[model samples]
Target: MATYVNPGSAQAGAHGTIYREVSPEQLAVEQQLVDNVVASFDACQDPRLQELMTSLVKHLHAFIREVRLTEEEWGTAIDFLTRAGHITDEVRQEFILLSDTLGASMQTINVNNQAYQGATEATVFGPFFVEDSPAIELGDDLAFGAPGEPCWVEGTVTDTDGTPLAGALIEVWEADEDGLYDVQYEAGKRAGRAHLFSAPDGGYRFWGLTPTPYPIPDDGPVGKMLDAVGR
Candidate 1:
């Protein structure tokens, strides 16, 4: 059995218990497994994809071994992810919430910001966006007959040179006063969602519910996970 030396009196060049516990032969076998797995992807013709998958495998294996992960803990993790998948449907995206809460969405945005340097920073796209939302005219009230305070918003679509970009599509959406989306309500209900086009001068305006901070929908598995973790 490997042992750790007394920390208070250990000499120079002392190594941690990790180095003492893991034999060189054991470490070699672990490394060979990582290499073999990475090598299996060599048949991939795309260089970029090959690089990404290889790096992912290497790091994922390192993390698993470094944490001394147990089978029970791994099974629990699998269960959590399975539940996350089960609760997602047409109107709910627990996975996106998981990514957002974990900061993966923000990091991805940061990494891809170079491609959108001149555009406005955007919030992570939620599942609230629906196909074939009825298009409304400029200056229309998006919150008509919907819950919450009436709000008026205006903006102009502009290019990097400050020139107006006319006819640009402007889509807007938000949670209602109760933090629920339009799709979450019963049939024929609508609130906090719409789209319109910019005017001839690139200026656009609309009336909608006032902005209010709200918690993510917590009725799903992801919400419960966040709650349990005190997020």
Candidate 2:
């Protein structure tokens, strides 16, 4: 029979040897790693770190005990995370989508947009939005070079009470008839998109083909996880 002792632990009959149980200081450092993430939950200036960190520490410690996770399990998790990062690119953002699918994005949106009760409910902004899209005039077609069914999208930005928010900016972007964003197609050319500003009455109209829902990029670790989960 063999006895195993964690490093820094004292063995029996080790004369004058002192063994210090894991101190609060060491625990605090380990706890801080998780705390840092929770503390960032609130928009700066609200500082919910104390509450978040406390809960995180409690659950994280509990999880460690619950599974009795070994270092190998932790290492595999790290590798999975690394692969997830490696598969990300400009057109594909596995990490952001992972967060959204996991409900973290919705949670963050709900927490940060507490003031948006009257506004249109915000959803997770997918990763395909392109800045400086070719600005087009109202009623201009966004699917100029694409081949999807032409659908007209008309909406009015209004306050919660139904008062129109005149001159509000409503930017629109979506995939073309081929179910691909401009970024997904050409390397540099901006295609299959258009941007239009709202009218004075908070109304905006755009002509674009309705986009068909497609499976997110399935070539990454996130995709593999989804497959494993039977999603």
Candidate 3:
């Protein structure tokens, strides 16, 4: 027989269980980890956190069991995540890109967001959006000397009832003709982005390059993963 102690853990039960473990008997039990964890939250302060943690534990554990994930595969996944973290910065969110590429981002939005009937639909925004963009007047060109096609856009904001909503603020940003956002340029050179307020009658207009389908950045770990998966 052997006795062991778990540092920082309090004693419990007749044998001083310390903290719960997947005992030999429990190994034969289905959903053992989920049961242990859900029962451990008796003192949980937040109801929502309890619900979230329990549900997450069950789903994540079930997924691992279903896949029978191997140790080597798990290690590779860890390496991928580590590189993704290293490559992320103030301007780049690799995790968001991961979610976006896997369609998880849109799927979550679809499940959570119910747009009002006749309301504008939402799409994935350009990752180049920077805060505190300079405001421009109607018809102002955001091109700002960036090489791109010249274009004009006009629109009016209105409620579901078709009544104009005045003084709506609008944010606009897009890639240049090269399909590179201003944030991706050297020294953070800004272009093809601006903000404007709608007119008293909810009318607005501006000049920007036409949108184009462009290849995503392929130099990071996430990009490599995408490439490996033939995305």
CA lDDT of each candidate? 0.76, 0.69, 0.76
- The residue-level lDDT of candidate 1 at 127 comes to 57
The digit string of per-residue lDDT tens for model 3 on 196-224 reads: 99898889999889887667777888789
Screening candidate 2 with a backbone cut-off below 3 angstroms (N, C-alpha, C), the clashing residue pairs are 39-49
Worst ten in a row by lDDT for model 2: 12-21
Query: Stretches of candidate 2 above 4 Å error?
Result: 1-59, 115-118
lDDT of 2: 0.69
Supply the global lDDT for candidate 3: 0.76
lDDT for 23 (candidate 2): 51
lDDT of 1 by residue, 74-114 (tens): 99889989988897777667888888888888888778776
Q: What TM-score would candidate 2 get against the native?
A: 0.70
Global lDDT for candidate 1? 0.76
Q: Output the worst ten-in-a-row residue range by lDDT, candidate 1.
A: 11-20
What TM-score do all the candidates reach, one by one? 0.83, 0.70, 0.82
Query: Considering every candidate listed, which one attains the maximal TM-score?
Result: 1
